[model samples]
Target: MKKVLLAVFVAGGLAFSADGAAIFKSKGCASCHQPTADTVGPSLKKIAQAYAGKKADLIKFLKGQGKAIVDPAKEAIMRPQLTMTKNLPQEQLEALADYILKYK
Candidate 1:
């Protein structure tokens, strides 16, 4: 049987990528977080840098299973947003993390 392709990219070989930027936009994340600016929330660059090589922890945070290491002061403000991310499937979470990490 031929494999069905959703979206494919070549990393080491063939790979799949979810549209994380689309996810961010559809989820209304851009309303608070910007690509490089600190608005109501921290910038994607800041988060990406803080979580560099720490994609697992970032996933945990997205799943509502970790603390805010980026900006503790804004934890309360960011908490509610976790509900939006916590229920995402593994693939989507990885995609989201990948998208954020691209800024690093």
Candidate 2:
């Protein structure tokens, strides 16, 4: 029973983490945001560094409650991306942030 429960927990973590990658792809974010290099928008590593120790703020930004910090000039370009994200449930947004944060 304990082994079964442990397996479930590990599986859950993997599943939740996978959502982050999926969200990035499905949201069309990769067009402008690369994992390690900047494209039209800032890179994920830059975003992670900018939001270091402030994951909650990052999540808030995704929710359309915070402002752009990494690429203010391209805020307009990134703004449209938020529309796709603003409606996502909180957990998914956190997962997205988690994936982005991993770049740091």
Candidate 3:
């Protein structure tokens, strides 16, 4: 039983670790933000650059607690989208930030 429980726990962590990309897609972030090109919004690469070494700020931004720094002029366009990210659990938020940061 203990082995089964340990395996389950480990599996869950693995799944959670991969959820960032899935969550980004499921949350419809791909529509505006491309991987490396600027479309409706800045590319993930641009975002990663802006938030490099600032994962906490990135998470805060996603939570709607931090202002847009990469493209502040376009922030209004992204305000409505915050509702999708603002309430994510901390772990999920961290994962999302990690995924975005990896583009750097």
Most lDDT-accurate candidate: 3
Summarize candidate 1's per-residue lDDT along 2-52 as a digit string, tens digits: 233323324423233467887888889999989899999999999999999
Model 3: lDDT of residue 37: 98
For each candidate, what is the lDDT?
Answer: 0.87, 0.88, 0.94
Q: Which window of 10 residues has the lowest lDDT sum in candidate 3? A: 11-20
lDDT of 3 at 89: 89
lDDT of 1 at 90: 86
Candidate 1 runs further than 4 Å off: 1-17
| Candidate 2 ranges beyond 4 A from true positions | 1-18
Compose the digit string of candidate 2's lDDT tens values, residues 18-39. Answer: 5899889987898888888887
CA RMSD, predictions in order: 4.4, 2.6, 2.4
Residue 34 of model 2, lDDT score: 85
Query: How high a TM-score does candidate 1 get?
Result: 0.83
Clashing pairs in 2: none
Better of 2 and 3 by TM-score: 3
